[model samples]
Target: MEVWDRALTKRVDPIRYDAETGLKIYREDQLNLGKGGNTPLCPFDCDCCF
Candidate 1:
C-alpha cells in the first residue's frame, strides 16, 4: 500500500492535486492536516508540469 492507501484506509483526509502538474494541493482538510489549496490554475506555462 501507499501513503494514499493509508490515508484512504484511515480516512486521513481529502487531497486535491492538479492533473497537468504533479503538485500536491490542499483544498479539503486544513486545520487537522495538510496546508491549504493552491491557485485554481497555474500562473506559468511550463510544458513539464503546467
Candidate 2:
C-alpha cells in the first residue's frame, strides 16, 4: 500500500485477483476496458497499478 501510494500519490480502489503474480489488480477505465484483469494495465507508473 505504501509503495502504491508513493508512486501514485492518490488513493487506489483495487480489485483483487488470484494469479502467479499473487495479488494482482489491473487498473482501467470504465468505458475503455470495463475494469478487472480483463482490462489492460493502467497508464500510471504505480507498482500496484502494474
TM-score of each: 0.26, 0.26
lDDT of 1: 0.38
The reply for model 2, stretches above 4 Å from the true place, is 1-9, 30-50
In candidate 1, what are the lDDT values of residues 1-50, reduced to their tens digit? 11332333443333766789866564434322333234454334322221
Clashing pairs in 2: none
Alpha-carbon lDDT of model 2: 0.44
Alpha carbon lDDT at 38, candidate 2: 38
